[model samples]
Target: MGSNIVFSANNNEEVMVLPVVPEIEVNKPQNNEQFETLNNGTINLIGDEGLRTFSIASIFPSQKYSWLKHGSVAEPFKYVDFFNKWRAKKVPLRVVTSRPDGREWFNMPCVIDSFTFKQLRNGDIEYTLDMAEYRFIGGV
Candidate 1:
């Protein structure tokens, strides 16, 4: 019911809202196994669902434009630092995404797999973040 994509590292209370709604890429692949049979045939078995990956590529504009959505957008480095700190802590973040009409779309615990950014010539920070779903195995 908030921004399109929001990151909450502390407990879903303090959230770092995005400045611009970037492209949220989701990848969920199925885990299947194949074995060779005795008659030169193959047997395929379907496994459980694989963890979904969430990717967001956007730019932090130095100055807020008229079309920007997010309300509270801080400095470019602030966002970079936010993810860096959470990543170093090795904690699972609650990633939430909603539709335009305020409907819950995808919500889950995800870990930051990789984050890359570059400073553009116009003082904007272009970044790409990759995160994977985190499942509690063997009872956390």
Candidate 2:
């Protein structure tokens, strides 16, 4: 689905934009033994490859265009930019990925510095908090 997303600038200008907001609702297991307490500061970032791929393909349907398309090539990088912007806004970031082990090599250091990248390694999700070295504006 498409949406008329809006962004407001400090100059009082509003820019109408289209953003892909994939909605995924998963029902948690009802068993109390499967429950885990989430800290208030924790921000779960799950990377759904299927959803990402679907959104990317939806934005640019032509396979021949590949990354040669105007904004299509640079679209993925915006996620990194978003991480930095959110950090500047004092939002805590925590990454959660279903990606298999060893895919962390594709990440850029600039974006990696803003969040605790968590992904499955050997059938378990592990976390690295190199980003937490800096102090957030809020008590994150």
Give the number of the best model, judged by TM-score: 1
lDDT of each: 0.83, 0.28
- Candidate 1 Cα RMSD after full superposition onto the native fold (Å): 2.2
Best by lDDT: 1
Tens-place lDDT digits, model 1, residues 59-105:
87777777566654747888888888888988788888888888978
Output the worst ten-in-a-row residue range by lDDT, candidate 1.
65-74
Residue runs of model 2 more than 4 Å from their true location after superposition: 1-77, 99-130, 133-140
